[model samples]
Target: MKEKIIETSIELFDRKGFKETSVQEIVEAMGVTKGAFYYYFKSKEELLRDICLTYIEDLLQQQERILRDENKDCTTKLYEIVYMLIHNIRTRRKSARIFFREMRHLHEEHLQEIKAKRRAFRENYQKLIEEGIAEGEFKQTHTPHMVTFGILGITNWSYYWFNPDGEISEEKLAEIYVDLILNGIKNREGK
Candidate 1:
């Protein structure tokens, strides 16, 4: 029942902005009463909070796992992390949209919590970039912080236009992104 409510809410919230989606509409979409929703989530805001937490926390865990794999180099780890982001965007398309787009609807406290988790996620990627630099795999021409944001900006923004059914597969998209990150799009031969 809880999962049903969360899933239904995600669909609705993704289709209609979180501020626009009402508890009544969510319950009706689930074919349940408000009591059913209240039994699990105190209010629609609480549901949104849960959705935000669940999405970021899950990504944090996945990021930690990739970082913990000692067998892989920083470059491989970075590639895997990019792939993970693209894969998550592909699999949890709706949830990813809501997680990134509807976060403004969360209360101040919940917003802070989500922001902290998001910061940790971004920091973890920055650390990976730092590691890559230390290992001589990545150029130190740019600051790690800037590079981290560049990587994230490229991959995260894909949620807005990435079409899973389009010409490029997620794997290919990850490769293209990783290539663009590692090797700039400049026609070096012309130089």
Candidate 2:
């Protein structure tokens, strides 16, 4: 029942902005009573908090696993991480949309918590970029922090327009992004 409410709320919240969605709408979508919702969550904001926490935390865990794999090189790890984000966007499009778009509706306390987790995710990317630089795989011209944001910005923004049913597969799109990151789009005259 709790999971039902959360899933239903995510659907509603994705379609209707969090501020626009009401408890009545959530319960109606789930065919449950308000009392049922109250039994699981104290308020609509609480449900939103749960959704944000679950989404970010799950991504963090996946990233941590990738980071822990000692066998993969920095370049390979970077590709896999980008693939993970793109694959997630492909698989969980609605949740991804809500995670990125509806977060501002959270109250200050919940917002802070989400921000901390988000920072952790960003740090993971920064550390990976730093490793790539240390190994001479990536150019040190840019700061790892800046490079991390660039990679994240490119991959994360795909949620807004990446078509799951489009002709391009997620794997191909990920490869394109990884290639773009590794090699700029400039055409070499002699090559």
**Relative to the unseen true structure, what is the C-alpha lDDT of residue 93 in candidate 1, on a scale of 0 to 100?**
85
Q: Kindly report which residue stretches of model 1 are placed more than 4 angstroms away from their true locations once superposed.
A: none
Candidate 2 RMSD to the correct structure: 1.2
lDDT string for model 2 (1-191, tens) is 99999889888888888999999999998887999999999999989899999999999999999999999999888888898988998667778788899889899999999999999999999999998899999998988898889998999999999986799988889899999998879877756
Q: Where is the poorest 10-residue window by lDDT in model 2?
A: 89-98
Shift in Å, residue 30, candidate 1? 1.3
The clash count of every prediction, one per candidate, is 0, 0
Candidate 1 residue pairs in backbone clash = none
* C-alpha lDDT values of all predictions: 0.92, 0.90
Q: On residues 1-191, what C-alpha lDDT tens digit does candidate 1 reach at each position?
A: 99999999999999989999999999999899999889998888899999989999999999999999999998899889999999887678888899899999888999999999999999999999998898999998989999999998998889889988899998999899999999989998997
